[model samples]
Target: MSTTSQLAKRFREVLLDGLWIANTNFKDQLSNVNMEQATAKIGSLNSIAMLTFHIDYYIAGLSNVFEGGKLEIRDQYSFDLPPLESEEQWENLKSKLWKDAEKFAALLEQMPDSKMNEGFVDEKYGTYLRNIDGMIEHCYYHLGQITLIKKLLKQKESV
Candidate 1:
């Protein structure tokens, strides 16, 4: 394979890995907690469900762009949940996330390395790679947040 194809393959792999890490990290934290506990905020940041939603928020934006849509943000969906209030709501939000992740992975698969430098600018992130690699890097950074929160939750649970 050409170097470009190799890069794209690695990028897609990382992108998929980020989604898995985010999902697993969050689930690990919320595992022991019941609906009542999961609903509680982890401080001023957001609840576990909200953080998970935020991770989905990023992936969803990438999906919109890959599909030739524009985005101010993904949570603009009429029923977006910033903070799910119940177990049923969290599970539903998670289900939507799974669908988004699957579609996003397919987008990654179709991407051509030639498009990596295509160039995109947003008021928020500014000019960027216009490639899956950059998006994967961004996703993993947020997944790290999930890991941190999960660690704290585990510590608390044991105490």
Candidate 2:
């Protein structure tokens, strides 16, 4: 395969790791999570609902970039998920998450290697490769937090 194709494949792999495969994928971590569990908190940390929204927020924002849209996300409002008060709401969010993940992965797979090496927005924001890789890392980091919080919530219920 050509170098661009190879880079695109690698990018897809990283996106898959973030969304589905890497042992600690978001899908697996979120399995069996009820709306109540998702909104539960462990101490001062964010709830699973908030964390999930936070993850999707950036993915959606970056996905916009790849779609030729302007970057309109603000970090300060990243965690502002609508209240996940009903099972229907949680399920809707999950549906949106899966759709966004798949669309984001497809966008990455279609990216040219040259574009990946170019600045994502401005020189200060860094290359698309760096931003994509950082997104993978960010997902894993928050997945850990999600798992731990879920465990703590279970423990609290048991006690």
Q: Give me the candidate number with maximum TM-score.
A: 2
Candidate 2 per-residue C-alpha lDDT over 11-127 given as tens digits, one digit per residue, 9 for 90 to 100: 444434444445556777776899999988777999998988998999899999999999899999899897877999998887777778778877877776678788888788898
Collision count for each candidate, in order: 0, 0
Q: How many Å off is the CA of 120 in candidate 1?
A: 2.0
Model 1, 67-142: lDDT tens per residue? 8888657445622556556778767766676677667766756666555556654545543344455665655665
Question: What TM-score do all the candidates reach, one by one?
Answer: 0.67, 0.88
C-alpha lDDT of candidate 2 relative to the true structure: 0.79
TM-score of 1: 0.67
Q: At residue 52, give the lDDT of candidate 2.
A: 87
Q: What is the lDDT of residue 128 in candidate 1?
A: 31
CA shift at 121, candidate 1, in angstroms? 5.5
